[model samples]
Target: MAERSTPGSTPGRLLAPPSLPDGAELVMRVMPMPADVNANGDVFGGWIMAQVDVAGAVLPARIARGRIVTVAVNQFTFKQPVSIGDLLSFYARITRLGRTSITVHVEVHAERDPVNPQLVKVTEANLTYVAIDGLGQPRVLTRQV
Candidate 1:
């Protein structure tokens, strides 16, 4: 890969961009608005976490084939600060499938600088969601015959 200045870094210095996780499926893409920015001028971490939860549920929702609720955020990491107007792409892959819960690994990448064009891994997380029934109780995942 051609070297370019890493996102949020000074120009003239070259750094190779990190590679996206293998086999992860693109789940969501969104750009933060000015309103999402925090006092430090970076996008609010809470907003990003909320987005992650939604993106992380994509695969589990499909597998659950019904109502599902986030039961846990097993892990979360912020690699870089997000800026307003940066296009963020969320990628997710199922790491575990249980009887009624599913765990997913989510990676968030920020694409910035229209002129230079850099994609940086900004945030990553592992979340678990449980299948729910009408009563909002955990429901067993039906086996495919």
Candidate 2:
């Protein structure tokens, strides 16, 4: 399989990606196009971050059963630079549930080189979302019990 190091880093250095964590659900999959690339010919980090936010909100929106807004990005890390044409898969698992908020851990993996077939961990993040009312104010989440 073709291996490429992160942009601006030492060349020929590759780290084996860790196994995907258990209990995470596949939330989304997308491939970046030429328009998503930056001047370096790599996908822009901001674009990936935006996608992560959307993927991280999926479960929270279902649990909130109404409107939800991103409250915080607790953590974000880019393990590898994403290239156009790489198939990106986003997985998310809920890590916390508060009275009006939900925190989710998201992992993004890139499947590249269709002929060679390599899966690389590209990014991971933790984000928090809060349920909101019609007025966009945070509201307490109702218990199912």
Candidate 3:
């Protein structure tokens, strides 16, 4: 139960988190498999990190207009634990752009209790990615759109 805004989302119910920003895009959606859960019965944070990394890359890859690789995870904060059977949605938006690197902010929301339907903010992170050339070298951006 929370009353504060979720940094980049609009306020919702106590169990439900605020909605995502207009600029943010729903890049990925998935349900955690039983194998992805930890001994505590919640989804492992590591698995979520991997998914976040992939989701965080969506916008930078488009902005780079070519190949891009994750160079850094600037920040990561887990607002709530994720569990199996929870439908997760990953949303992302560009936060900053550099000559060869792009920074993005990503947020993950979980929809649980199918009958009652609870939406909660599970995690959020800021990641940086660099544009890469065919040779794997940093490539300068040609345009910003």
**TM-score, every prediction:** 0.86, 0.85, 0.86
lDDT, candidate 2, equals: 0.87
Clashing pairs in 2: none
Global local distance difference test of model 3: 0.87
lDDT of 1: 0.88
Candidate 3, residues 28-74: lDDT per residue as tens digits? 98999999988899899999999999999988888888999999999
Question: Which parts of model 2 are misplaced by more than 4 Å?
Answer: 1-18, 143-145
What value does the lDDT take at residue 100 in candidate 2? 93
Model 3 TM-score, all chains together: 0.86
Q: Sort the predicted structures by lDDT, highest score first.
A: 1, 2, 3
lDDT (tens digit, per residue) of candidate 2 on 1-145? 2355655655665534458787788889899999999999999999999999999999998899999999899999999999999988898999999999999999999988854556889999999999999999999988531
Q: Which pairs, if any, clash in model 3? A: 10-18
Report every candidate's CA lDDT. 0.88, 0.87, 0.87
lDDT for 27 (candidate 2) = 86
